[model samples]
Target: MALTDDVTSCLIDNNKLFKDIIYTAQYTATSANHLGYNDSSKHNSSSNSSNSSNSKPLPPCFDLKDAYRTQAFATTTVPHDIENPSVKRIQRRLVDKFLLTMRSFISSLLSLPILALLVSVAIYKTTVLHLQSSGDQRHHSMDEKKEALDELLSQDETYYIRRWGYACDTHQVLTPDGYILKMHRIYKKGPPEPSQGAKDTKKKPPVLLGHGLFQCSGAFVLNEEKSLAFMLVDAGYDVWVGNNRSIAGFGHISLSHKDHEYWNWGLKELGVYDFCSMVDHVKVHSQVDKVAYIGHSQGNAQAFVALSLCPEIADSLSCFIALAPAVYAGELVKNFPLSLLIGLNDWFYTLLFGNGCFLPIMSVAQQIIGPKIFCFMAYSMFSYLFNWWDHHWLRRRKAKYFQFTPRPVSVRLISDWISGWGRQGVLLYVQSPPPPPPPQQQQDGYRATSMTTTTVSSMPLPLSAVGSKRKLPLVVFYGTADYLVDGQKFVEKVQTCNPFPMLDLVHVERLEGYEHMDTIWGHDNHITTYPIILDQLSKVSYP
Candidate 1:
């Protein structure tokens, strides 16, 4: 009874203490039996009496352990009946709770994807509606555009013909080789001024303007008002827009040679022959010992080659202003895709587009996706996003006017540019192959040739021909952010030329915030940058 009382007290205080009380009671009972205590029946009888009394609903002081032990033993004894029911109820509750948790977890995982799909659908609908609205607005804008175009055309007629008295005269100049090179002379009547100086002295200083690749004089002399030609003419410069050979304005040939393939030549031939011939003709027609040269892109390349190869023209040039000049193609092509394409196929390009035969494949490609007005607009928009202000101006300026007669240039010329001829001159100056060891004997040394012909192979002319000793006044202006030309490498190569002792004049001017095309086509070209160039020209002494 005492053991039962102690166990009941331990269970009420803490359930874990009941186990210790049970163990201690069992050990004491075993020790009393082993010591031969004869009162075993009395202890057993007392314990049974206490259990029975607790089971019969006795007072609070009655043993609760005996009742609890009796219930636990009954629960274990009825395994087949009550035990199965209780276990099944607990298992069902557990399964229901697990399923609820799983469903909540699955829904949480799918929320993001479902939300994203809904948002995507909403955006698509909004875009479609916006596009439909824009189309309607465009239709309305078209009528407005037409009215504006008519007004602009009327203004163009008045400004170009009636007010300014500008005229475009097409002429032919015969080269020594008997090729009749076409020329376009856009001149305006002299501005009203006093006759204080010589009669010819009052004539405006002629500014010969050249255009870029895949363009003509019309590119620069765009419209009556915004055209560079018109601006220069208004500013009292005799504006002569030169269309390089094979361009729209310069495509005309002599009747005898109209069908000849020789008339269609690349810049390699253009630089050597066409430009040289044009310079000669301009000098003779103008009757001026020297003239100012302003060239854009390919025009600059042609000028460099002509001046360098034919030093005689150097005396005839008052000053050279190259806009986005492509003189050093090796350095100019650092970021351009054309450089990689050319490097891949330099050895095989001649077979691809040689002997006046254009590549049919490239021709087809160009025809399919040629540089159209819309394409130019899109490119200009992207340029604008990148802060290429000049390109943006070029796009907006050109879009305001329509080209009357656009001409097709030979694919062979483009091929030559991609292949090597355009790159060869610059590469020779930049990439020097190891020199042949000084001849084993004096007699074995190679001798320099004195030929002055310009129809050499794509390889650069010998260093002797370049005249390593002559230090010509070389001024290179490049844009730091230009994608076409590597301004740093160009400066380095020019320094390596070592045009020393005779005033190795290497003036490198970096135009900030300019891209490859902005040098010529930028909006503020005439106002912002041209005066700086003119100042440089004033310093040059013409022969």
Candidate 2:
């Protein structure tokens, strides 16, 4: 009788605990085929004891991770109450409705662009053939021309690097937050002769290049020898290119792309985990005390935010070179449709588009359209969005440029940018409180030692830990005509506002006719911008 009583009490306790967990748990939707609970007929068919009178109803779909469940209680076979089945039925219906609506919306949205691209491709081919027949014929055969075009459309970054007589190595960096990022290291094909009075090949300083929003490391090498990556390699500096986690695909130690939790991050996580891990990896691999960092557009924002949160990593940087810095987007916030979309609050946004990757159909379409057609479509979209014209880019390399960009980004990352736009700052998603007493800092064009001696891994510094006194050399290149971000304003604010203290604004240049992407992809950038960047890098690294 005592054993029976104890068993009853135990079952009651477990049942109550299980109920609490289930009620509080957050549920994510999977397909009806993937989730057994969503398909009652299948579940009923699979059950052996369906006819048994003593058998209890099965629990509603529980999507909680293992961390949420207590081991002892997890094994407890508790059944659902009468109310849960109906609730779950409603949930399943709502999920189905939501997914169907999203799919329909996406399909409708994509149809126009897909149709436009098809037409554009047809016209592009017609024009090429017309040009060939209209006395524009070259000595090369049609097959050769097609072969060259195919190579341009299909080659990856490593292909270009090796083609340009350089060696490229791929390294996988594991972030503290379980993300695995792929990085590229570029060097000359053979052992580089020791520079005059240098120790050996190892003495060559390392420069890390980070790409802009929706771009991968491939952007740095797309322009062949004229690209910044190749230029740096030719200038006798080791070049390493950094990529975000979702560049090629969703890379994580434990989470698959299908998992909702995998997409639950924003620019904050990028700065904290991505930058920290990549910087450390570069520092350790190069066998150097510090690395010179260069970033363009959103790439610049990541570094700035990373420095703000984790001052300790500043020790690993020799200097920072920002190309079209995206710190202050005050003017950009006023742009059409984008302004309207960004104005929506988080809950409403998630309600409208579920919490997943942002505009996944774009990726799907990109894959389906093939590289050549996708490149034409990408150019059209960029031209419309940014008011950029074909004249802004190097004409010959334009197709190659589009082949690499517009990689997958999370909806949360875009939300984080919107949040920052509201604040009119680059400090994404984090409210900036009044900082402590300003540390003794150096002014423009001066170089100082690193701020902190403490080496950190993965963890960001606390807010109280701001105000490092060290001077980190910074060089800025901004386009006067660039409407995407107010780079001039970013320079002004960092110099005057004194946001953390280590930022030493050394040199500032305003390119008169340049636009946002002109810093890297413009025809004259190799002659006009690359030399100046090389000079700054050399000053900090060799000094």
Candidate lDDT values, in order: 0.44, 0.62
Compose the digit string of candidate 2's lDDT tens values, residues 76-104: 23321111222211224778777756754
Q: Top model by lDDT, which number?
A: 2
TM-score of 2: 0.68
- How many clashes in candidate 1? 0
Query: Model 2 clash pairs?
Result: 445-506
Model 1 bad stretches (over 4 Å): 1-165, 177-179, 189-191, 194-201, 223-226, 249-260, 330-340, 343-391, 400-407, 421-475, 496-508
Tens-digit lDDT track for model 1 on 82-133?
A: 1111111122477876764564445435433543454455445544544665
Question: Residue 177 lDDT in model 1?
Answer: 23
Candidate 1: TM-score? 0.53
Model 1 clashing residue pairs (backbone): none
